[model samples]
Target chain A: QKEVEQDPGPLSVPEGAIVSLNCTYSNSAFQYFMWYRQYSRKGPELLMYTYSSGNKEDGRFTAQVDKSSKYISLFIRDSQPSDSATYLCAIGGTYKYIFGTGTRLKVLA
Target chain B: EAGVTQFPSHSVIEKGQTVTLRCDPISGHDNLYWYRRVMGKEIKFLLHFVKESKQDESGMPNNRFLAERTGGTYSTLKVQPAELEDSGVYFCASSQAPGSEETQYFGPGTRLLVL
Candidate 1:
């Protein structure tokens, strides 16, 4: 089975709408969960990360990890056009770094 | 301090040509990593370096690709007789260590187009 799975969504939302992105993993050994944002032609940038199961909030971004369910999520509150990009969910197992096919997010102004 | 930097932001070469992509990690970082994203696929790890030593290279696709981190500094990934399937965006990232919490800074990435 694939280690991590995410919907490759071209999800469009009106500006100011709340955006939620999610991923599910099959490995319980994954202890590190993270969200990265990538703009065209640029590399992925670390948005927020959480260890194990917990919710971390940074400004308008919130990252939640549910270890029991092997699920994780990133929520962007008060989204704006500047928030448009590809959102990638990454998980780290003991030996490898696994990433999901990113969800393309567009916050239309 | 400058973030990770990669050379030749984009390269377009025909199959069978060799292409060398370079990455300069942030100074003082002891860990370096290489990842690639093919069209319609997720970004995948290729290999990782600790100083001049390879910590793990299990993700490398095959023998056609070779990566070197000589003298514990800048690194290079070379693809000989590149295949059309080898086209992708190659990203280089570095971190102080592989802790559960340390941030991995990324380079601008080099786009390789093998036609």
Candidate 2:
């Protein structure tokens, strides 16, 4: 089985809608959970990072980690068209990183 | 300060050809990394460099691929006699602190197409 699994989504949402993206992993040793945003032809940018199972809030984005189920999520409040991008979930050790297939998001005005 | 930058934003070569991709990490950053992603696949770690030394290179796929970070400033990944399966985007990233690496800044990867 793959270590990390995420649904490849072309999820579409209306402007100002709440968007929820998620990923599940089977690796119990993973300590770092991160979310990244990527635009076309650009590198992925770190959006949310968590050290363990818990919740973190940053501006309009919220990240939640549930280590028990090995599930993590990123919630975008009042999503805008400008917020449209590919969302990637990544877990890593001190020296290496593993990524999940990203979910493509589009917010229409 | 500018983020990491990669050269030859895109490359197209035939199978069995040699291709070299370059990465210019952020200045003063001691940690450099290489990664790749094929079409519809996730970005993957290929190797990590600490200045002029390779701290971790376990992710490299095969002997046909070679990576070097000389002088601890810029790095290069060369694929000799590239295979059809080698067609993918190669990325380079760097971190600010040498210890407990965090928030790796990535370059606009070099998209490679092997025909």
Candidate 3:
């Protein structure tokens, strides 16, 4: 199994909607979970990250991790067109990071 | 301060040709990483460098790919006799420390196309 898995979603939502992106992992050793935003032709930018289980919020973005289930999620509230981009979930190990196939999000105006 | 920067934002080369990509990390960051993302695949780790030393290179696909960090500064990855499968976006990231909790800042990435 792959270390990390995420839906390659071109999930579209209207403005002011709530958006949720999720990823699952096979490695129980992963403790650092991160969410990154990538626009077309640009590199992945770190959005929010959480260590172990529980949620970490920054402004309109929230990241949640469940170690038992080996699942992680990012929630974006009040979505805007500016939020339209690809969301990637990364699991950090001792020396390297395993990234998931990013989900593409498009918020309509 | 400036973010991570990569040179030759885009490159297209023949399958058997050689290409070298460069990465300049944020100043003073001890940890540098190389990652690649094929057309439809997830970004995969290539290697990690702590200063001029390679900390881990388990993810390197083959011997044809080589990476180096000199003087604990900018790094470079060279692909000799590049294969068609080597086409991908190469990303470089740097962090202040080696731990998992440290945030990694990334470069704009170099998009490579091997024809």
How would you encode candidate 1's per-residue C-alpha lDDT over B27-97 as one tens digit per residue?
A: 99888999999999999999989898998899899999999999989999999989999999999999987
Query: Higher-TM-score candidate among 2 and 3?
Result: 3
Q: Is candidate 1 or candidate 2 better by lDDT?
A: 1
lDDT tens digits, residue span B1-115, model 3:
9999999899999999999999999999999999999999999999999999998899899999999998999999999989999999999999998867697889999999999
Over the stretch A13-84, how does candidate 3's per-residue lDDT look in tens digits? 999999999999998887788999999999999999778698899999999899999989999999999999
After superposition, candidate 2 runs with Cα above 4 Å error: B98-100
* Per-prediction interface RMSD in Å: 1.9, 1.8, 0.9
User: On residues A38-93, what C-alpha lDDT tens digit does candidate 2 reach at each position?
Assistant: 99999988899888788999999999999999999999999999999999998876
Which 10 successive residues of model 1 chain A have the least lDDT summed?
A89-98
Sorted into a CAPRI-style docking class, model 3 comes out as high
Off by over 4 Å in 3: none
Considering summed lDDT, which 10 consecutive residues are worst modelled in model 3 chain B?
Answer: B97-106
Instruction: Give the DockQ (2 decimals) of all models.
Output: 0.67, 0.65, 0.85
The TM-scores, one per candidate, come to: 0.97, 0.96, 0.98
